[model samples]
Target: MTASQDVLGEVLADLRAESAELDGLVAGLPPTGWAAPTPATGWTVAHQIAHLAWTDQRALLAANDPEEFRREATKYLAGPDAASFIDDGAEEGARLPQGELLAHWRTGRAALEEALAALARGVRLPWYGTSMSAASMATARIMETWAHGTDVADTLGVVREPTDRLRHVVRIGVRARDFAYAAHGLEPPAEPFRVEVTGPGGQVWAHGPEDAGCKVTGSALDFCLLVTQRLHRDDARVRAEGAEAERWLGIAQAFAGPPGGGRERRGAPAPEGDG
Candidate 1:
């Protein structure tokens, strides 16, 4: 297969694996379980999955009708309710019956995969703030699935085992370094920092200029948790070797949208191990 096709296949495979794992977590839950509050303030377990479904719908629209997607996006971004649109969409979906919501999420995910798979090479889909190729879109979906799935698992007192699928998340986190700075109105460092993390399979995954003085190193789980804002910087085990690199860790964001109010610094986790 061509390299581009290979990327599309690999990323979509990982996306399916990540989504299926989260589905397994919520599929068997009792109706009452949907109401369990997660770490995201005012968001329930149902809201988490609902948000995923809502975003998947948006992704499908972006792939199928970029012009319409842009029009809708511009309208939303200009409306007074723009700040709360994400919450509002999740709330609307969460109000459905548990079974109905589950089915909606499943259908949306399937439609998204099919739409993206049929796209031609070098096609770019417009997103909330940027555009991406089919493979990049799939990787972003995987990253969100794993991050939100972490929230759901935490709510249910379940500890999810980190998997190699996080390579996608890690890559996004590393690539988004400049976006993170720009989101916060700060200029990124002139030189790229070397990022090296131990992967789930104990393999070392590295990025950036090898000769750069700035560096961030940690377990993949720790970095993912931090970049996704699922874990506070104080609670993550990631290490930074330079002043700028350290500051980047403090503002790193892997997902699109506003700068997140990250989880509170709860010192209980003891910064010794990976999430």
Candidate 2:
């Protein structure tokens, strides 16, 4: 298979694996823990799971009919009862028992995977504002699952090991550096940079030009978490070096659209090492 196809396959696999992991984790949660606050502000464990399911359902709708997807999203955003609408949906999802909730999560994820698997390589689906191919969409899903899953795991004191598939999340994060800068109304640095993450078995996953103006180096997991905003820059284990690299470090993002204010690290120190 081509490199892109390989990456697509890996992303799909990771999505499935993560969905399963979330299912198992939620299945064991006590009723009280369902309403327990997670690291994600104003969201309990149930809210997180429901958000995933809702997002997947939206994606499926978008894939089938882009116009309908846009209309619904816009209507929801513009409605007088927008807050109540969202709250009601989430509340309905949160009310599901652990077993039913997990089953719903699995079903939604499987449907999304099937839709992605059926798409042609070049086909684009409406996402946020622009269009993205199946591969890009899959990559985005991987980043979201891993990042949000970290929040759940953190609240429960579960340490999830970094997987090789997390490279997709890292790549998305690297690509989003420019968007992060733009969100802040700053012009992205003109110079390019190199990103290298140490993965399992001593494998080094590097992206961008080898001799780029900047270099970011650190563990794959740290790099993924940092870029996804699951962990703050200071809280990450990765180190970046060079002026341009440091600039990119300050504006890295994985999510689409304008950059968020981002979560605080509480008492974490800025990540050390080379960019």
In terms of lDDT, the best-performing candidate is 1
Candidate 2: pairs in clash? 215-275, 216-275, 234-270, 234-271, 239-274, 240-274, 240-275, 241-274, 241-275
lDDT per residue for candidate 2 within 1-275, as digits (tens), equals 67777867877888788767766677778888778877756677897787677677778877778799888877876789654554456567878886687778778888889998877777788876357887788778777777768878887889776777777888888887877787668888887779999886578989889988789998888888777766667778788889767776766777764454455676643232101
Q: Under the 3 Å rule for N, CA and C atoms, how many clashes does model 1 have? A: 0
Expressed as tens digits, the lDDT of each residue in 128-237 for candidate 1 is: 85799999999999999999999899999998889999888999999889889998999888898899999888998899888889999988999999999888888888
Each model's lDDT comes to 0.90, 0.75
**Candidate 1: C-alpha lDDT:** 0.90
Q: List TM-score per model, in order.
A: 0.96, 0.85
Query: What would the TM-score be for candidate 1 when compared with the true structure?
Result: 0.96
Q: Single out the weakest 10-residue window by summed lDDT for candidate 1.
A: 266-275
lDDT (C-alpha) at residue 194 in model 1 = 96
